[model samples]
Target chain A: MTSPAPLVVGFVAATVLALTAACLLGSTPMGVERVLAALIGSGDAGDRLVVWEIRFPRALAAFLAGSALGASGAALQGLLRNPLAEPGVLGVSATASLAATFFLYYGFVSVAAWGLPVAAIAGALAATALIAFAAVHTRSIITLILIGIGIASFAGAAMSLLMNLAPHPYALSDMINWMLGSVANRSLDDIALAAPFLLCGLVVLYGTRRGLAALTLGEEAAAGVGLNLPRQRLATVLGAGLSTGASVALAGAIGFVGIVAPHIVRPLVAHDPARSLVPSALLAGLLLVLADIGVRLIQSEQELRLGVVAALVGAPVFVWIAVRRQAARD
Target chain B: MTELIATGLTLRVGRATLVDGVSFCLRPGELVALLGPNGAGKSSLLRASLGLQKRSGGTATLGGRDSERLNPVTRARLVSYLPQIRSIAWPNVVRDVVALGRFSHGAAIGTLREADRAAVERALDACDLLHLANRRCDTLSGGELARLHCARAFAAEAPLLLADEPVGGLDPFHQFRVMDITRAFVGRGGGALVVLHDVALAARYAHRLLWMKDGRIVAHGTPDQTLTAERLAAIYGVRACVDGLRVALEGAA
Candidate 1:
């Protein structure tokens, strides 16, 4: 019977620990004292440059992106009342990536620095709207997910087309890197660009927490309890779209963090969907920071993609959960 | 005072009219049972009257406000609904499932308030589930799960309760236990509109009976008047012997 207060305290502590480790344990390692000084603007130029300019932004991006994805996943799972539901399951991330790749292929980056994220968000919204429409028409959860998968496949094909027709070798390589997903080399500007959308998405999802909890009883019962189903649906889909879209725009398709984070924290929150959101977000931020740290630590000829590490670690966990769920059903 | 009032309620889904021109008033201190065969619009009428479904034409009011226009919080406070389908998506504890009733009362997100806790405790006690309050809902037996859902509706402590087959799939003892709880709810100055298939139980427990057929209420009165042999044969196509509160179905008409 782990209560929410203690669980939140534990997660916050863990997040702080992970954040500190991420700042201090990079390729050119800095001592704790130097990291602390750099954080407070009292360290020398090179130390500050290493800590503030490089590692800080990347860690912050990972944290923000993970938090957004985790909150979005929790919200989606609650709304759908399906444990397997995640932002990726809804085709949002794929469509956002497709849009970003579209912009990258056409050299839309020259139009404006914010062009890619804006395009990604727009694509995410469009895909979410399509899925929402399909979901409303279909009562079956399986059908809704199948429709989402269809949309994802369509977007995936479009992305492949963009890659095949990439204008130059450099553009192709950049698209490849973006598709692999990384928070490395990201600047504070990238974080700033994605922050507002992420924050807005978090707020939207947070506001729907109560409604999501009600929905666990099913839609009619939720409505009977005075939950506005349409409004809750809009907030959840739009929020997921915005947060996931922004995350994909900033960090490519970082898979499994959204789905994995909530699964880890769900039982700790006593399976209360509304109570699961904040902890899931915090834990997800921690998970992503640690994963990013792992990306740095793994000695390889070429740097491992953060997304690759997440999926490599996460896919097996997902399969294990599915198997366990099947066993339980039996 | 009237807890729920409906007038000329009609529900149509495309070309089908599930509930047509049905009207009823539920008052405090009364437990009304809605009995009908399948496709007789019992569930649809309840859903439409509660504004959970779109009514083609009519008005339903709860606590003197139009149910269609009532805000969610106020509507939740005025009426509690127990749908026929009983499902707990997650393996939430019994207490948490009951606390969902307080969604409109606020504090649905964080820790429960003192009042909310008291209400949940009271509900658990009423349904005789306090001992199993911490048990995971998915692990509960069918009868226990039925009682748990009853407790969820009871937790709302609203003036009116609309339950669709609240005791369906329960054993005999639990069935009577649930009906007794419904009766007790009305005895304590609340109102209830329950849909039941058991004519004998409805006869024994309900204060009145609303017998429906083909999307219309063919009879609305005391148990004696509504469960007549002629009506039983005509509506349900069953030959039945009725003795006081006990009804025995003999054969198909």
Candidate 2:
């Protein structure tokens, strides 16, 4: 039995290393000396502007978004008692993206800086409520996943409709770029806007960890051990909704970091769902920072969307996991 | 003194009465077996008594307090429950599963207190599961999983245990082992209400027998008084012979 403490420490260290790389390795690359000098307020104006203004906020946003998704995914998986469960699969991210896109397409985002996240959170909560209602009627994991897919498809279609109805080509292209999902070009203001909702969601999810752990024995047994099922359910749904919504609001619809990070961390934590949250969040932050760095490294006419890279990397892994699970069952 | 008392307990689901005004008392140092045919409301009675199900009428008290009104922690400390449908959603190890019994005992959020560890150890030993403590629960056989759940309930150390067929899928050796564990729990001044389909095993191990048909208790007394051939025929629709503490089903009446 390996202790989770070292694994968590290792993940945090890896995230720090990735964050440093994300900050230094962008289009105008900075040496380690200049990066360190910029942090200490002694570098040239260009270096400081490039490091602090351009890269620092984007790196932080990517890290925060990834942490939110990872923690939310781990919590959702525990609540649903299904390893395949994730914010993206559950339609939370897609619905959130739809709401944010709606705001952006309608030019409402220009009215209030917080409008996008607020709308996204509302959409996320609505989708989560729908899923929670469906969950009560079905005990089959596959059925729940199918319901999630249906919801995701509906939201995706609505987003496309909004894209088609955009009044101008600029707005249409803006919506398209935002829907593609990226941490690039995000400002500190974006991070500030989404941080509160993400923090609140994380707190709620953390509070439900004990209940989620108890649920591994099934609902009746969990309640028998004094867990308040209704309260736990509410907390889990609300938490996952808020965090996932805020992540999408900050970085569009980055998918699979939530699902992938937890899978990577679960074994390190001895498969204890409750113990998996913090490590998952750290690993998720690392994954997103690395992916964002990958976006900058690949030289193309236009940089690849962070979401596109994540899916390309994550979809194959997801298939491999599903196949492996099927083989194990056989 | 009574560890559990239920009077006129009733459960209804959409106009269907599953348990109708069932009442019983479980005293310390007593092993009571609830016996009945399929759909006789034995499971519902246990669930309702533990406040796991809504009772349309009547009330249940644990240690002289209304069970329904008690806080979850206090209720869990007073009465432990073992449901018939056994499931493990995650691949948790056996010791971790057993330690969940201490959820209300200050084992919060994956960290177990000293007392929690001690209780889990005692329970694992009692159920003869110490050697398999580190094994993943999903890998265990049905019988071993059943014992693991039994061990979990035992770990709670609640005064009253409400078990719905705790020995349902075990082999003969394990069946007797589970009965002995229940007997030992009662021997230590704990009370138990067990639902069983095995009349002979119930007759041998239980201090008292409660026979039900439909949704009510039809007979309640010593095994000798409750396991009569006429009662068996009436309740189970079968003819059975009761010799000493053993019961054998002859045929359907």
TM-score of chain A for each candidate?
0.95, 0.97
Model 1 C-alpha lDDT per residue in residues B137-202, reported as the tens digit of each score? 989998899889989888888988999999898899989988888888888888999999988898
Per model, the share of native interface contacts recovered reads 0.65, 0.56
Quantify all predictions' global Cα lDDT against the true fold: 0.86, 0.86
Q: How do the residues A26-112 of candidate 1 rate in per-residue lDDT, one tens digit apiece?
A: 778689999989888997889998988898899888888888888988888898887777767677778888888888787789989
Q: Clashing residue pairs, candidate 1?
A: none
| TM-score per model over all chains | 0.96, 0.97
* Interface DockQ per candidate: 0.66, 0.63
Clashes by residue pair, model 2: none
RMSD of 1: 1.7
Per-model RMSD to reference: 1.7, 1.6
Model 1, backbone clash pairs (residues 3+ apart or across chains), number:
0
TM match of model 2 to true structure? 0.97
